[model samples]
Target: MLDDEARRALSRWTVGEPNAIREYAHGAINQTWLIETARGSYAFRRCAQGGAEVVRQNHRLIGEAVARGVPTVAPVVVEDGNTVVVESGRVYALFPFAAGVQVDRDRLSNNDIQAMGRSLADVLEALRGCDRSLVKEGRYEVCVSEAIREIDRLLSVISELPPGEPSDENALERLTTRRAWLVEHGVEDGDPFADFDRQPIHGEFQDRNLFLGDGKVSCIIDWDNASWSPPEWEVAPFLDFVAAYDKVKVAAFLAGYRARCKLPDERLDACVWAYGLYRAHDLWLFREVYDRRNDKARRFLTPGRFKPHFERWLRR
Candidate 1:
C-alpha cells in the first residue's frame, strides 16, 4: 500500500487526482504501483536499490533512446523539470501507462520474436551512440573461485534445511548437478570478451520486459539494468530463446538485428558462449528462494533451466 507522504508527493506533478492505486504483483526488485488518476493512468515506481542518481541516469538514456525512435515509455517530467521525485528518503518516478500485453516466451510467434530482436537492436544502437561517460564500465568476466565458493555455501545450506516442498528437492538436485559441471568446466584463465567492443546495453532484455500487441512489440520497459557491455552480451539471450535451436528463427532474429546494427558472423559463437557462461554462474534464483525465502523468485525456477545453457556452452 502507498503511504501518505508518497501519495502527497503525487501532487507535485500534474497527473491529476489519484482514484485508485494498486501495486503490481510481479517484479523482483522495484516496487511499482498502477495509479489511475483523473487525467490518465500512470505507473509510479519506487527505486528499491539505487537512489535518485540512478533514476536520473536511466532517464537520460531513455531520452536518448526516444530520440532515436525506440519504442519505450519515457518518464513524465514534474513541475520542477525533473523526471524523479525524492520524498521520505525514497526515490520515485512516474510514466504514462504503456498500452500492451506482456507475452510469454512460449506464446511468441516468429514475427513477434523478430520484432523483439529489431527493437532490442535499436535500443542497443541508440544507447551505444550516447555519451559513454554517462555509465560505468560493466564487467564481462566472472571469477570462478567466487562462484565455486557460493555454490558450496548454497549446497551446504540446502543440505541442512528440513524436507520441504517439491521445489526444494528440485533445487537440491539442480544445484548438485551444476556443482559437478562447474568444477569440470569453468572459465578460469582468460577474459571472456577481451577483443569485442563494449557499449551501453539493456542488461536484462528478456521476455518479461517487453510488451506486445497485434503481434508486434509496442514498448520495451524496465531500464534499471542498462549498462555498458559487449553488444553480443545483449544478443545472446535471444539466441537461447529460439526453440529447439531452430536455425530459421535464429536467422530471422539476426537479420532483424543486422538491419539496424552490425553483428559479425565470427562473433556469433562467442556471443552464445558468453550468455551460456552467464547463466552457468548465475545463482540469484537459488539465493532468493533458499536464502531470502522469496516466493516471487520461486516462479522463475523450472526443471533443468540452467542445464540447457551449460550443454550449449559444452557443444560450443
Candidate 2:
C-alpha cells in the first residue's frame, strides 16, 4: 500500500532507505506499518487527524511514562530531532519495533488477565505525579447527551427497516427489546460526578492496545486517547468490557489492580452504574452516529457484530 511519494516521505525518518513496508491489519484510527531498513525495523504510524501537535504531545507523554518505569513505546526522534515528522501533508512518527503479541479478552488466560490489571495500575501509578495540566481535558468517550441522541436516532432507523424480512424483522425485535431494557433500568440512581477524584488515566486501555512478551506486559501502545478524567470514567468501561468477555477472570484482574490502588466496592459500583449508562448510549450510536460514512460504524451496524454485545450489556 506504499506509494512512491509516501515511501519517499517515510524514508526521511528511517536510518537508511525503507527496504520494505507492511501494513499492520487491525486498526481504525491510524495506519500502521512495519518498516524495514538496512539499519533495523521500526513501527511507522500515519495519523489521519490531530496533526503534528497531537503526535508531539503523545510522544512527550510516552516519554514521561517510560521514564517512570512504565512499559511503553516512545517515538524515536527523526533526523530533525523531533518525534513527529511532517511528510506529504500527513503526520508520521517512527517507533522502535517492540516485539510482542496483542491478546484479546477472549484469549486471555487467568495470569494474562491479572497481568493486564497490574499493567493498567502501573500506567496509573506512573502518571500519578506528572503535570496533570499537560494532559488534555475532553475525553474521547461519548458524552451522555450525545449517547441519548444516538440511541433515539438508532431506534428511528430500526423502525424504518422494511417489515416481513426475516433478518430485518429479527433485528427490529432485538433493537426494540434493548431500547426498552435501557430505558427502564440503565439510568443511575445518582450522579457519581458530583465530587470525584479526577486524574490523568489511560483513556482507552482495552485489550488490543496491550502488548505481551514472554509472560509479562512488554508494552502498552496507542497513547493517542490519553486524557485527564475521573478514574471511574475509564475504569468503569474497562470492567464492563472484561466482564462481558470472561467474568471468571474479573477477580484476578481486580486483585492485580488492588495491589497498586484501592478500589472500594462502593466506588466501583458507582463507576459501574456510570459505565452502564455510557455503554447503553454507545450501543445505538456506535452504528448510527456515522451511518455509512465510517467503516467501523458500518461494521458495527451489520447484524450480529455489535448488537449482541449491546444486548449482553443490557441484560446485565
Top candidate on TM-score is 1
TM-score for candidate 1, residues paired by index: 0.88
lDDT string, candidate 2, 245-283, tens digits: 345666778887888788998876666655554555555
Candidate 2 has what TM-score?
Answer: 0.81
**C-alpha positional error of residue 165 in candidate 2 after TM-score superposition, expressed in Å:** 12
Backbone clashes under 3 angstroms, per model = 0, 0
Which regions of candidate 2 are displaced past 4 Å?
139-148, 152-194, 243-245, 283-292, 301-316
lDDT (Cα, tens digit) per residue for candidate 1, span 89-188: 8888999988698877777777877887787787776777777755656765677777778988998988887886667777878888887877888867
Give me the runs in candidate 1 sitting further than 4 Å from their true place: 1-6, 213-216, 241-248, 291-293, 305-310, 313-316
**Global Cα lDDT for candidate 1:** 0.78
* Candidate 2 lDDT score relative to the true structure: 0.69
* Clash-forming residue pairs, model 2: none
For each candidate, what TM-score against the reference?
0.88, 0.81
